[model samples]
Target chain A: MKTLSLRNLQKTYFDPYAGSQVTAVHDVSLDVEQGEFVSVVGPSGCGKTTILNMVAGFIPYSGGEILLDGAAVKGPGPDRGVVFQSFALFPWKTVLENVGFGPKMRGVPKADRDRIAREYLELAGLSHAADRYPNELSGGMQQRVGVVRALANNPAVLLMDEPFASVDAQTRMTLQEELTRIWQERKPTVIFITHDVAEAVFLANRVVVLSKGRVLDQIKVDLPRPRVWDHLMQDETFKRLSAQVLQMVRSA
Target chain B: MIASGQRTGSKTPGSGWVWRTMNSLAGAAVFVAPLLALVAIWAIVVPLFEVNPRIFPSVASVADAAADSIRDGSLIRHIGASLLRVGLGTLIGVVTAVPLGIAMGVSPAVSSFLTPLFRFFSVLAGIAWIPIATLWFGYGFGAIVFVIFNAVFFVVAYNTLLGVSTIPMTIRNAAASLGARRWALLTEVLLPGALPNIVTGVRTGLGFAWRGLIAAEMIATNVGLGYMLFVARDFYRTEVIVLGMIVIGLLWLLIDRLLLVPLERATIERWGLVRRT
Candidate 1:
């Protein structure tokens, strides 16, 4: 079943001062099946984030519809969770509070929400820092809190916008591995947006390449898991796929 | 790279209490030095010039007057009266202005239209309101409190509006996407994001209020620091006038350094999510 579908999505931002409309996303359409790990890759300002924003109902699209579980997305809801690039954890909130926010918003019992948040925090290897505020944590640790916050509510679909972009290279690799493990265990339909082709190829079951606010191609990653970082680099199949994706990205 | 386990965290070689006490003492010294210097200059210059003791008192005479006022308890009464007015006016202004500002700021069009109105009023807050406030509220406590209220209100409202409007759209969107409801977004995201600005506004507003308080007291009130200074001028009691001036400066310095600065620091340190340059 198609868990989520974007049909000819178009977005136009109006410049009130200039008296002109700028087309940010144009005629982009895609679908994600249940339990699919789909990654969207594009150059900077290619409107990939715009598509995610549309699906998350953060902005109004000029045209087309975003259907989640066969219903139109009207506005932001608890059914979908989004992880932002900047790790927008509430600074006033501790790790545990930030993670528990979604469930608390849904009016879940405090004990249950705390339990769920604890599970996700442990999954993200941030249980030890649960009581600490976001500012006290490192970039990687903060991103872990972001991930845990998104996953705590057990939403049907997860939308991530360059979730690991701010962290260091070492932390990024570790987080990628941890994310893969979590996805395999939880199996929520995910639509991940990133500029990095290697990151997309490593985590995604299907990779959609976007350029100039339109879909260029969608490639399938047929590799088996648990996929090790070192093994992925050494594998000839991985190399070939990476080269192909890199070529497309460069051309775009 | 050092192994995590092998890395030893550097210690500052002092207990938290010791460090805090030292910091406070240093801060106090830094604050007091200038005032002490000014006093020393005044003491020396006044005697050297042999200026009329009526116009400017010697240090010894001013010290004697200060002691007399303290002994009689009139100094405490005047200080208490000024503080009460400022305290009451500030409380009322903050309670009223914050919600109104947030409501107006939530809508961009309304906020933009009303911004000019706030700016105009904020400019006219302190000394300018004195003549009218005295006319409407009569002399003494009412007039002084009205002046202080006007001084704090408009500036706080303007700052609150700016604070809410300055929140990045990205942060709001991220919160919305993460399942924050309207109330949650307001309390968790909007409030904290605007806190630093609000604190800054309060500091600025209080500064204006303090000045306005003194000026209004001088013109329209019977019992306060400004009144004390004015009465001393009439009686040619330069010693009392000098003491009053010193007291005013010290009071303001204490309010700003002890109360306002720490409050601002805590807000920026805790809720200011963005890194400083």
Candidate 2:
């Protein structure tokens, strides 16, 4: 069953001074099945973020609709957790507090919320830094906190917007592995957006390439689990898949 | 390597104690330099001109007046009176201003319409309020404190509104997506995000209030630093007037440096989101 669906989503911004209108996203439609890890790759300003924002209910669409689990997305809710590109962790909050934020908002018991937040922190491999402020942590560690914060609520779908784009190369590789492990364990439908082709290929079960606010192609990655970066990069099949994604992103 | 050495030095046992002692001395020297220079200039110029002791006194004479006031305990009474008024006024202003500002700033349309109103009122807060405050409260501590309260309130409210409005939409959206309710969003995201600006506003407002307090005291009050200066002016006691001026300057410097600067630094250190170069 499809966990999420977008039907002919359209977005336009009016320029009063210019006496004209600009179409940001035009007639875009896509669907994601249950437990699917889908990556959306596109060029800059191609409305990839707009699509994600619409699904997250951050902005209203001019036309069409977004349905999550057979219901229209009215506004931002706990059922769809979003991890932003900038790792927007509250500066005043420690790692544990940030992670527990969702549960606390839901009026969960203090002990239960703390326990769940601790588990998510450990899952993100940030147990040692749970008491530290976001500024005290590295960029990768901050992103980990963002992810844990989102996941603490046990959302039905996890939305990631270039989650690893700001991290160092080595940290990015490690995070990808950790993400894949967490995805397998939790089994939430994931929609990851990135400009990096290799990232799309490595972590996604299926890759959806978008261009000019339209879905260009959807390819299934039938590879095995527990993927290792070093060995996988050497494989001819991995290279071929990366080349295809690269071609789509470049042309877009 | 230098960075490592600095880090190690910062962390070494007993180093913090030594560093804090040195830091305080450095801070005090920075504060005291200008006052010392001003005093030296006064000493040189007064003697050079052989100025009338009625209009302006010699540095030695001003020092003697200061000692006399201190010994008589009038200096303590004046200082205490002024401090009490300022404390009460600031407390009332801050408690009122912060909430009103946040309420106004929460909505875009409301905030835009009200911003100009706040700007106009803030401009008229301090010195302009003196005549009306004196009319309403009559000549005494009440009138003087009213002026100080008016000075702090509008400025703090204006700055708090700006602070709340300037928070990035992305941060708010991020918090919302992470399941923050209205109350949670306000407390966690809005308040901390606006803290640096609020602290800055408080500092600026207090500066205006301090000045307004002096001006009000001169006009309305029977006892205070400004009253002391005014009384000295009437009696042609130039030495006493000079002493009062020095005391005012020193007191303000102490409040700004010792109290406000550290408070601002601690807040920014704790809740500031932006990285400093």
Q: What's the lDDT for all of these models?
A: 0.86, 0.86
The CAPRI quality class of candidate 2 comes to: acceptable
Candidate 1 regions exceeding 4 Å error are: A15-19, A109-115, B1-14, B272-277
Q: What C-alpha RMSD separates each model from the true structure?
A: 3.7, 3.5
What C-alpha lDDT does candidate 1 achieve relative to the native structure? 0.86
Candidate 1 lDDT over residue span B1-277, tens digit each: 1221221122543354577689889988997898789889988999899989987889999999989999999999889998998998888887788878887878999999999999999998999999999899998888888888888899988888998898877678767776788898888887777777677778889999999998999999888898898898999998999899889988988898889888876657654453444
| Model 2 segments more than 4 A misplaced | A16-18, A109-114, A250-252, B1-10, B13-15, B37-52, B273-277
Worst 10 residues of 2 chain B by lDDT: B1-10
Give the number of the best model, judged by TM-score: 1
Show the lowest summed lDDT stretch of 10 residues, model 1 chain B: B1-10
Candidate 2's residue-wise lDDT over A1-252, tens digit each?
999999999999897887899887888889999999999988987888888998988989989999999999988888889998898888877788889988998889889988999999999988877777788788989998998899898888899999999999999999999899999998889999998999999999989888887888888887778788987889788889999988988888
